[model samples]
Target: MRKRERLELIKKLILEHKISTQQELLDILENAGQTLTQATISRDMNEIGIIKIPGPDGSYIYGLSKDKLRQEGHRIDETPSILAVSPLVDGLEKMIHVDVVPGTSRLIKRQLLTKYKEMIFSLIADDDSLLLVAKTDFYQQVIRQKLESMVVSDEQ
Candidate 1:
């Protein structure tokens, strides 16, 4: 699997289970038909900002970093905001196109997915742009407004 796919799977597993060890994560991935090494998993975890937080049972388990949880009112990292470069949001129907700073599209895509999961059907990020497919044209407009509002809030 690709690194992005593996990262998404790791996030899913971490969210669904109280995984506390690299070995356990490795085993789960293996069972899921993914052949990965401990080192690769370690790197993926760090890349995605996964950390060990207290689970319900008082033991530590893998979880997303609070800094990465934008939906929970946490401030995202100091990368440029979605409108920092004046992202061009254009759409014909259910698809919206956004121009982003080079190398920041993936981060923007992740935040958008987290904050607007129900509205987004699929999101693709390239080096300097994002293509977001919403459930409908109305949802696409909502996403566009939200992106603009992010810049407004950031400016205030």
Candidate 2:
């Protein structure tokens, strides 16, 4: 499987179980039909920003890094990243929200596909705007908020 696919699976496993150590995480991967070394699990943990929080048994289970919230989050909305793109289409679910400068849609689209393929399913890009298809509608609001903040930051 691709690194992105592995990461996605890892995320799913982490959410499903209380991962306490590298060995446990590795075992989860192997059970999922992907095997990796302790080093790879370490790297994945860091990359995904996993957190070690105290579990009921007094051991720390890997958890969603709260820092991710600081980085940013979003909610889906009617205004799809751009004017033309939309939630209007049936089965056209959104997965990410990203923004780029005017006339840089193609550039942004390329970069997103290259850099954040895991976070997005499909993409639509136009001048200064981009729409990302996500696994769930929950990400749409996050995308919208992140893009709005970027626009605000640019104005500042």
Candidate 3:
């Protein structure tokens, strides 16, 4: 398998099971017939922006940074980060809600505006989330889909 294929497998493995260490990941890859070294796995993890987050059992599991929702003692969900994609209107009629990694909200907002400047009215950035205000429901859906697509592509 190519490096991208292996990385995708690694992401799948992380999502499927609570993988906390490089050795565990290597063993899983070995079982799947992809022989890779610990160093390679480490490099891949870095390249893919994987981080260890606290699981339900208080053990750390590898996942994308954006996968974490910072609430006190909250356990990380098994669902892939991309799976958290949802666009819901807030109490305000034109406001839409979405979350991203802590530091990248501004960049994502900029990208969203750049891509859908006509549809998106404004973006309100929070600590680790974004509230997108679009011109209409149709425009909101378009914005949501675009944001979700960006996140899903990042996972690859």
lDDT of 3 by residue, 82-143 (tens): 22355464666667677665444554565567778899788887536777788987887766
Residue 82 Cα positional deviation in candidate 1, in Å, after optimal superposition: 30
- Which lDDT tens digits does candidate 1 get at residues 4-71? 88899998898898898889999999999998988899889878867665568977777776566664
TM-scores of all models?
A: 0.46, 0.43, 0.44
RMSD of each candidate?
A: 11.1, 14.8, 11.7
Q: Which stretches of candidate 2 lie over 4 Å from their true place?
A: 69-156
Off by over 4 Å in 3: 67-156
lDDT of each: 0.74, 0.60, 0.68
Cα displacement (Å) at residue 74, model 1? 8.5
Which candidate has the highest lDDT of all?
1
Model 1, which residues run further than 4 Å from truth?
71-156
Between the candidate structures 1 and 2, which one is better when assessed by TM-score? 1
lDDT of 1 at 69: 66
Q: Name the lDDT of candidate 2.
A: 0.60
Q: Indicate the TM-score of model 1.
A: 0.46
